[model samples]
Target: MTQKAKSRQEIAEEFGISAKTLSRWILKEKLQIPQGLISPKDQELIYEKFGKAISK
Candidate 1:
């Protein structure tokens, strides 16, 4: 199963947070974020660290 890559903004909105906050979290955790989109692996890591995005 392949997961589509997501943009930082998309992920942040899903998590009910600002992209800036997400950046802070990423920096705090020292996670690597790709240039354009968040890879499936990194997306999973974010989901694990911060629960999956809130259901709309």
Candidate 2:
């Protein structure tokens, strides 16, 4: 089966934050990111910590 993927923008949108902020968090190890997209392993962890962002 193919793995699912989510862009930085989508992940940020889910946390109500900017992509830049998410990038910084990844750099600082504040967020769990493997690369350009959020890995499936970290998806649940992210939502557990930050919940969902209000999409416009």
Best by TM-score: 1
lDDT of 1 by residue, 1-56 (tens): 22789888988999888999999998899877766788888898888888777745
The best candidate by lDDT is 1
Q: What is the TM-score of each candidate against the true structure?
A: 0.83, 0.58
Tens digits of per-residue lDDT, candidate 2, 5-50, equal 7788887876778988877866675764577666766766665666
Clashes of each: 0, 0
Cα displacement (angstroms), candidate 2, residue 16, comes to: 3.2
Lowest lDDT block of 10, candidate 1: 1-10
CA-lDDT, candidates in order: 0.84, 0.69
Deviating ranges (above 4 Å) for candidate 2: 1-3, 27-29, 54-56
